[model samples]
Target: MAHITIYTTLLCPYCHMATNLLRKKNAPFEEIDVTARADLREAMRAKAAGRNTVPQIFIGDEHVGGWDDLFALETTGRLDAKLTPRSD
Candidate 1:
């Protein structure tokens, strides 16, 4: 499986929703809490292309945006492909 990383805040509902979906799919992910860490938040912003949102997800170095984007991928049947490890 491709490595998953998600930057999130403590009280963000979207973050919870995103994580719930990942859990349902049995996808292991590294969750970075940027609630009280300015440095980490800055790093998240930099990696997310200036998106200061609570949840910024990355799947194997590919920026997957926020919860809506991730859910879209799931609904469209593309998320599994992204999560699967590439033979190459």
Candidate 2:
């Protein structure tokens, strides 16, 4: 499984929705609550290039943007391939 990291705040509906989608897909993920960590929020901003939005996602070291972006990837039929591990 690919490593997934989600930067989130407790009150964000998008964050909850994103995680729910991942859960429905049965994808393993780690959630970092930026709400409680000022440093982490700063780091997320840097990593996201000033996008401080909740549900900022990272897939195996790749920045995957927010919930809409994830859904867009899914709609385009690319999410599954990325979620699966490649033997080569």
Candidate 3:
């Protein structure tokens, strides 16, 4: 499986939804809480190409955006492919 990283805030509902979906998929992810850390938030923004939103997700270096983006992937049945590491 691809390594997952998500930048989130404690009170964000979207973040919770995103995490829940990942849990259902049995995907192990590193959740980085950026609620009280401006530096970390800035880092997330930089990594996300200036998308300074809660729940910035990355799957093995591929930026997956936020909850909506992730959900779209799931709904379109494209998420599984992303989660599986390429054998190349």
Q: What TM-score, computed on C-alpha atoms, does each candidate reach?
A: 0.96, 0.93, 0.97
lDDT of 3 by residue, 1-88 (tens): 9999999999999999999999999999999999999999999999999999889999998999999999999999999999996799
Candidates in order: C-alpha RMSD to true structure: 0.8, 1.0, 0.8
lDDT of 1 by residue, 1-88 (tens): 8999999999999999999999999999999999999999999999999999979999998999999999999999999999996798
For model 3 the TM-score comes to: 0.97
Taking the tens digit of each residue's C-alpha lDDT, what string does model 2 give over 1-88? 7999999999999999899989989999999999988899999999987898888999987899999999899899998787876979
- Provide backbone clash counts, one per model: 0, 0, 0
Report, for every candidate in turn, its global Cα lDDT versus the true structure. 0.96, 0.91, 0.97
Report the error of model 2 at residue 77, Å: 1.2
User: Which candidate ranks first by lDDT, i.e. highest?
Assistant: 3
Error of 1 at 77 (Å): 0.6
Rank by TM-score, descending? 3, 1, 2
Worst lDDT run of 10 residues, candidate 2, spans: 78-87
